[model samples]
Target: MKREKVKHMSVKGGASLFALRIFVTCLAAAAWWECLFSVFPGMVVSRSWLYGAGLVLAVIIGGAVSCPRRKVAVPAVILAAALLCWRFFYVIQGAAAHLVNAYLAVHQERGFEVRFWEEGSLSAGTLAVGTAVLVCVPLLTILLLVIRWGRGKLVAVLILLLPVLAAILEGAFPSAWATWMLIVTGGCYLTAAGAGGRDMAGPAGAAWAGTAIAAVTLLVLGGVSVLAGRAADVIRLEEDGFYSQTRQAIQTGVVDNLNAVRLRMEGQDEEADDRPEEEEQLPREREEDRAEVAAKEAPSASDEQSETPGDSGAGTLPWDTEADGMTDLASVARFSPDGTAAVDVRLEEAPYGTVYYPLRWGGAYTGQSWEETSGEDGRDSLFLSWPEGLDRLEELCASWPSDTVEEAEKQIDRELTQKAVYDTEPGRTPTGEDFAEYFVFESERGFCVHFATAAVLMYRMMGYPARYVEGYAVPASAFSRQADGTYLAVADGTMGHAWCETFEDGEWTVREHTPASDGSASPGSETQTASDSALRHGQAGDQEKAGPGAMRIAGRAALLLAIVGCVIGAFFLQAAVRRKRRLRVLGGRNRTKAVEAIYGTIYDRSRTMGMKESSPLREETCRRMADMWDSIKEQEMRWLYQLVLESMFNEKRPSAREYRKAMDIYRKTGAEMYSRLRGWQRWKYKYIWCL
Candidate 1:
């Protein structure tokens, strides 16, 4: 009875130790995330409360799922952590890297110029969720694993150092809280090591102890953080002494190394990315061979010089011609769609013979709107991949609109089109950055204006002189022969459309590349395939078709069943894999680790075979299993219990002879366990759960 009481107390202490570590680790991770949230505010939507909520959610998830007692597979925990914080991994790293570069660049003045401004950053809400899942969730999981079963104290210290150092490197002050968290975590871990899983009595008591520790830590650390932020200079540790000199040197070295590491991570060297912006560049530098070839083939800036209005606007694009254009590019003009023709086109064989006539030019692209900048010097094409997933489209139709015109500027082009005209699109708000950003990145369904706006922006980004032109399309088949041997196309208000024109190779070309309005591929759309068209068109027809509807339902049902069956199959498969791994250890090297399998196999086989309690480690369970056999093997049962104890409490591994004896009992115990059970229970214990 005394031995049983001792074992019970031991289990409680172990649980308490694990629970304590988990709580402290979560606190450390949340504090780190909070610091990161401050430094990189753009991680989520621009709201402190939202990021706070996200941090809370991540901490809770990390603690609950990663508790050592859960015994979750390492790979599964990693996958779950990744899935939880997938959004942050996708955007935060890149954005934060850029923001760091920008911050450093502002200080450097001439090193590592980037295009972060041109490329829009993340929405605040997305950032909040991603950082929580990516950083906090993973931090908790890693720390828990490190504290519970990791190699050494040094590993845990190194892991804890990352966030504290990152916050410091990012130049975020008031980072005392994170630093304190790290210091406290290290101290707690050391204390835990000294105690050796003893001081606390039960899991519940451990939790209360952890909460009290965390609260005291927060009170002290939170005060320090606030004080540091409010009066950093007042409490500055600077004096004319050896200590001060050494501290400054260490600080400088650390910062330089961190920067070097960051540059390497971003795939850049010290002298890299300092080239001409107009030159061709790849989105990723991992393809070093390709990037070098591009650099070699790129034309120098002096090759073709274009006239620039000294201060017309700081940007080369239409909106860049004015400060407001950078913010208000393409605010859609509002009007009720009462069949109004935005522009009429009349031409012999469609001037460019591609899409529509572009009359008005939206030049320098500022942010808010297109600022028309006057240049007319040289046609430029970067001929490169766009950074923000915008492929530089070569819509240069080999004929300049200026070259075709003789007397009038745009009036003659508008008067010379003979064909169908598309109508002005329905007025709707296109928010964020500008109409082009909304159209290109966000809008899946929008009006013709969106298509045209995005096209013009892509062309400008390609380094070609392009303009957003609202004009009527000329579908050749819609035109009829007039009495004068000429085709007469009606400029219907319903046929109004928009397109883009650009100067390439000394000629003006138009590209009326817009997605089809019907949401399926029109005959001439360059973007979609027949399969996509069939899938999209099938959406409505599946509901309408009686025969196909039944098949669709059946297919869906089958898919659901397959998914459910696969989930159940996976659970069984994982159990089998774990058991197989344990069995190998039972007979393999490292008999110490294998000893648990000796008890585990017997425990599992005896579970539902008249055993009432679930725990297999109990002495009562050992006696019950011993009772099942016809001939009592009391001596072997006592030895089996002793082996379990040695595996847990003793440092030394079980000898080969000891393990062999356990295995023999393991087999006999299983047979005796099966003989006592009813058929179904035996099958369940022997195969399903036992296996």
Candidate 2:
């Protein structure tokens, strides 16, 4: 009963309503494209926002197929497409170049992790053809929905929500309120239209009513957006250590798999190279046994550790995986610590607590050396033996106090030292492809470098973008009080430190993952000679923008729901306006004209009744229309046409009774036309055709 009450929709506003839906459909698709492209603007090649908006292709194609009231829109669209292709030829070419250049990187303007791909190639002609195809195919797919709007609700919704969802996953939505409003407004109506409410096709007033309701929604959405923007300035959500670790763990696993695939595809024999081809019993070169690091003496990084793992080729030089997935650990393990002070930072205050000062970040670690690999992407993966020793490290970390980061790290200092020794087998160097594994399982010697390297992998396993860091560590104990009540400390290469840091709150923080210095075990992490940490993660809020959290995502979803409500209310209000308009014209002034208009409306609807090959039933005369009407309603159509003609051309206005009689005839004619349509066609004629 409820369905029947609003089921009979008028066909009066079908075309206009459908056109609006089409417009929004294209808009939604375009929005989706823009949002995604924003994440990787380099994908557009030209680095131009205008060029990135690939929806121009869809708009042109859609326009081509639409009626112009004079039927000449197709040629215009074709001309426009041609002009666009010619105008932005460079953009297309750039896109092609981007595709060809394997070792390419996006512009620094994007402020993304400095990304690099391999060098690949393609012919110019092939590129041109590829670009053309790429531009047209998706546009055609989007435009295909114009043929049927009362369907494809899911498809339409997917397009409209693409960017919104992408923004959520990426935590980077468009800043513009209008973009959100457009998507919400279009999505709301598109959802209703897709429900195929053929039984409730919107009347002429639906447009105005929908617009009004949508306007209110727009206002509300604007206010919410503004509040959200302001809230972002002051409110901060620091990462929960547990969740951060979990998320990073998942990400690291995925990165590890991708890296493995990439290595295999690139035919990298790095693993094979890590192992010696012939294990000839070559005489070991005599090397100095390492001494503990002290205020005056610095221990050799290479000579401090020895291999204890039973794995083949266990004793190898430290290797660093380059950003380009290549191993370049060809240098001997003897890198003397630089004695020159390259960087000097003066501190006016005495430091007492555990401090971390991050300098250079290395995203990839070779068995021997750390490399600033990949890009700024936080998804940096450990190159070799990435997670071999992660479980044990995580277990060890679990027993530490959670009261504070520093306290926990202190516990790590004592416990981790107990696990691995600082003494290397006399003159034996620690290095291998499975270096991390060896370090984790063998309980062998580990100096600052070993602890720093292995600790990074351990941190990564615990769900952090653990980056290897190497820089000078100024000793806090070096500070001396002055007469003016100021304290000063001086640092040089003797305080050189190699450690790891964790990504937190948009920047990296030095985490004391390396064991604390205990000179008794030959040397300790940061070395006995090394000072406290130097880099901190105390970044200001304005330094980097924060991504959306769960709460923000929920707010967006709520906004979407509110907009959907507005869309529905708009159509219902439109229905009421349509009724008032019908009553005013049919029963108030202009009786003859009103009756004539009603009959003419019914006559127009009749043209589409039988779904004929020649649409609009363009017969000039009522007799011709009757002749073409093959159904039993032919006589009824003929009578209705005659009545409409008489009313249209009548000289004198009709009386109330006469007008009622004409309306009666008009009502009967509408019923007859309706009856002529059978099954789904009846529903289609009432809802879809008018919709």
After superposition, the stretches of candidate 1 with alpha carbons farther than 4 Å from their true spots are 1-22, 34-122, 150-152, 167-178, 185-691
TM-score of each prediction? 0.29, 0.30
lDDT of each: 0.44, 0.45
Q: Give the C-alpha lDDT of model 2.
A: 0.45
lDDT of 1: 0.44
User: How well is each residue in 1-691 modelled by candidate 1, as lDDT tens digits?
Assistant: 5346434644565555555665566556555555554444433334464446554654454455445544455556566656744644556574455445544533222223455443246666655554455444555555655554423557667776665565456433324444665566555553333222211121333234434543554455445444343222211211233433454455357644675587789888754456554221111111233222222333333423211112222112211122433223344532122222222222332111122322234555444455543344324332211224233122322222434322122322232111111223323445444455544433322455555555565545444555654433434333322233333333233344455555655644454455443321111221111111101111122323434335434444554555555565465456445544554555567777666776776665555544565567777777887775543376778787888887888776788788777765664454445445575664354336643
